[model samples]
Target: MKGKNIFQEKETHKYDDIIHLPHHVSTKHPQMALSDRAAQFSPFAALTGHEDSIRETARRTEAFLELDEDKKEQLDEKMHVLQEYFSEKPEIMVTYFVPDEKKAGGAYVTHRGRIRKIDTYLRRLLFEDGTEVHMQYIFEMDGEIFGDTE
Candidate 1:
């Protein structure tokens, strides 16, 4: 798996054939093993996985679909290179792949972000906690940046 989503809350199919007891009989309880797997993966269930992170990137902005699916991949590939400069190198741009109701057309939707202000090449950002809000992650639903001009 390129990226495993073991953090998701989903059904687990873990099972063990047999378990030997000290002096009595052997056990073939499948539920116990299944529950064990569930517990093992539970710690990260609430944490963000790949898809979650992608969506989180969109929730922050409304212009996630400026590129088509094919183009989005191209953009994502380029954005991945571009993301290398931002702190955490987050995939925050592609989050807006889905079309929202406010948009008239489901075509390309680009949020105007001033690339000059971003220092993604350095993998650092001006944001305090390292949230590299990009054009795609802009706050405005109309694809506008909303924050300090600087």
Candidate 2:
């Protein structure tokens, strides 16, 4: 004997006849591929290169250190020792500063190689594999080859 609400009753089917009808076909353009259709809804970047710019800004680099006269003298003496042992193909570790291409600061890198040639004309120390380190940028050099060559 409970009364039913007017809105709660199921609505009569009005368009049930055409509801199952085939979708209308277009005569003008061919159907788009499923992948292409899905791509239309994919996320898009309105600001081009924004992410790259932010990443470049966030990139960090080290500052180059200035060597004092005493340190410079020590480096010079080491270079002299290395030059004497150059013919022996001495294995050494050379630490040098490399300037950043895009930032104010640079970085220090250590290279391990056998000395091939010291090009005073180019002011660079050449390695066996053609790697060259500028004399002005060299911070330190260490090896057993420089031990007894006083």
Assess each prediction's global lDDT (C-alpha) against the native.
0.41, 0.88
Query: What is the per-residue lDDT of model 1 for residues 29-81, given as tens digits with 9 covering 90 to 100?
Result: 53457778788877565555988667755654333434457654554455444
lDDT of 1: 0.41
Name the lDDT value of residue 19 in candidate 2: 84
Query: Candidate 2's residue-wise lDDT over 3-89, tens digit each?
Result: 975555544455677889999878998999999999999999999999999998999999889999989988888888888777889
Candidate 1, residue 99: the lDDT equals 44
Question: Where does candidate 2 stray beyond 4 Å?
Answer: 1-18, 148-150
Distance from true location, Cα of 117 in model 2, Å: 2.2
TM-score of candidate 2 versus the correct structure, residues matched by position: 0.81
Residue 102 of model 1: what lDDT? 48
Query: RMSD to native for every prediction?
Result: 22.0, 3.2
Model 1: lowest-lDDT 10 consecutive positions: 141-150
RMSD of 2: 3.2
